[model samples]
Target: MRGEAGLPPVDMSVKVGPLALPSPVLVGSGTFGFGEEYAPYCDLARLGAIVTKAVTLRPREGNPGPRIWETAAGMLNAIGLQNPGLERFLAEKLPPLVAAGHVVIVNIAGHDVEEYVKLAGALDAAKGVAAIEVNVSCPNVSRGGIEFGRDPAVLGELVRAVRGATRLPLIVKLSPNVSDIVPLAAAAMEAGADALSLINTLLGMAIDARQRRPRLANVTGGLSGPAIKPVALRMVWQVWQALRPPIIGMGGIMTGEDAAEFMLAGAAAVAVGTANFVDPTSASRVAAELEDFCRGQRINHVSELTGGLQV
Candidate 1:
């Protein structure tokens, strides 16, 4: 029951490039802002790592009026990557959490490739940023998002540009909006991504039948939570087969069993995003259950379960 340093041994310790972790139950970026908003409920140290909200090149007011509209299984978000920008996030937001003792993964976005490089270089030298996750899937953004992600060449170029800018490990957050995931993942890995996180969200909408109008201000919002699970799992398996990089499987994970399914599908690690919106302590609880299941299955290490499935 005891591990190194006499700590309680767990089965979910995973890896991201050179950084090995104590668990694979991290909360997703964008949903969790700067790693402090949900602190009242869960211990930050219990997660494999914390991916902060998406910070942009400049502060954005985001979309007008209503940004989130509840759907049957998941919520549609048109938050538009509203953030404090890199300067504010590093100076004001990340410092305090850096001292709080957790691996910090900063999710970042920009309007252009140059902006991405600039932000990447700044975060690479940042005191607390353990890694940078490129948010290529934010649909509401004007540039450096879907335009780049929709095409393999553009996505590769954007990732390579950011990779050249920073010494820190890069985790490219891939979009499910693309047609073929194989070409996309292959492009990212070839362009110098240390790891990849799938997926951002599937494009969806909501309609108020009584009013005969669209619900979200943007009309269309990225669909996250449980609704996108099946597609996300398929992409994870495809990308794992194509490139074989460290894959962070996410999208619609709500239970410990769901997290286990991601690992079985070839995810090196799993992230809980929209599920956090549903259950405040979902990440920690999932971690505990994952460990317990590992013990029951007689699996000594969680890493042994990665890609356990053939198809």
Candidate 2:
């Protein structure tokens, strides 16, 4: 609808699975830090949603020293999903998040199918938890690692079991290390995932040639940043062509144009990750820039960018 000035007020709202968001820009888990770290940097309520770092049934110490390393165009980290366990998160972090008025989506990880179910059930009862993002694609863990995200059949079972355990919207985060991502996406949706977040992180490593040692203590870590943007867009486009579920496209989104590229490639929304390290308000910046872009292009709404790519 046009505003008082007659130009259409860009509608940035988007629905992913069952959750409705005010804007299409969300902060990726791990980077945003439960919405508290950046609360002063940007308005958390202005974002579509904030996905917290992966929380487990038990607290994790994460990986050893040198867990993060900077590369040419991106950074690699094998932080190993360090997070306060679900119980502590509920007792401490969650209340403030809700009180701060931010829409929260808890990202959960598990060592096994039963663990996933247990986490889902527990989070379902937590107040102020908007949804659950199943972190099946972390490459740093020894148990239940990327294996759960790589196998189509196994992923299906996991999703189905998680579905049975919770009533909240389920978003199965997909791994980019797979041979083909389409089948993995299909399996997740078929197993009852309400939405999907694609291209978690590409498996990569940085080495110190002179020292003959890996830059990261874990030797390898998930690669994220502008380096993976093209790969992410391709996968989002592939899944968008074959699936009807909303996708939270993420990987190397650093700017408004990058987010728009993902949207045009078929993402219902985009998540900002690595850029957060450079600027805490990257998500809000992207959203503001996106609106400016829509105005310049005469696009009535940002949602029109979704799947608007032409051959």
Candidate 3:
């Protein structure tokens, strides 16, 4: 299809394992809520997919007051995976997005391996779930609260179990707090992950100088935004070089150029996270901007940007 001004349309469709997306710009989980929340701001159909917020087996109230703190170029959050639980998600949340004909990739977190398996199994049976993004950033209750993604062995086991439970395309969301991310990425892929989500939030903290207290009630929270873009890009490059698996890159992506940077670093697709809070229409805007970038570079396919970086 051609766009306005007699410009040829850039083919934006991308594949994340078995799931195919209309665009490479997806709204990251937790930031976009469910797809309907942003209906008034942008066209949902323009997005690659809507990754729903992390859903648990039961309802959660999330973190206490002071859950958010703005930093120099990013923000910290300890929302604690607040959600209305699995049953409600299937019965209520999933239906609307599917009914609207939006591609839905559900982000799920569990305290244990069994919980992960159960959640995956349930989603496998549900209609309209294009994929499952395993949020291994959540603490593993069975392992002294150490994040599942922090330990390669544990993450592998978890992914293996989830893989067995569902036939859906599986994407593991890796944590950036690790000493090296390549091992974790390898583990996920070896365990049957179709794709990897590079760099979840980095661990960070803030303090109230005068009061001598921590800024967030949780004492530490996940840091995200422009400040982490370089780190995220580096990680994506390292993992892409090491494993070459499809990566859904995210972290401080505020513009199309930012998304392009990730693509060059080896991300098959990009997700808009912290930027969503800044502009509800950020994902769609990024998609348009990426197409514009392709046109300027005389690139016919958006996929051509992936791993196009020059040493």
Candidate 2 per-residue C-alpha lDDT over 279-303 given as tens digits, one digit per residue, 9 for 90 to 100: 8889889888887788878888788
lDDT of 1: 0.85
Every model's TM-score: 0.95, 0.97, 0.97
lDDT of 2 at 298: 87
lDDT of 3 at 99: 91
Candidate 3, poorest ten consecutive residues by summed lDDT: 138-147
List where candidate 1 sits over 4 angstroms from the true fold: 1-8
Q: How do the residues 123-207 of candidate 3 rate in per-residue lDDT, one tens digit apiece?
A: 9999999999999874312321237888899889999999999999999998898899999999999999999998788889999
Q: Which candidate, 1 or 2, would have the higher TM-score against the true structure?
A: 2
lDDT (10s digit) by residue, model 1, range 203-238 = 989999999989998889899989899999999988
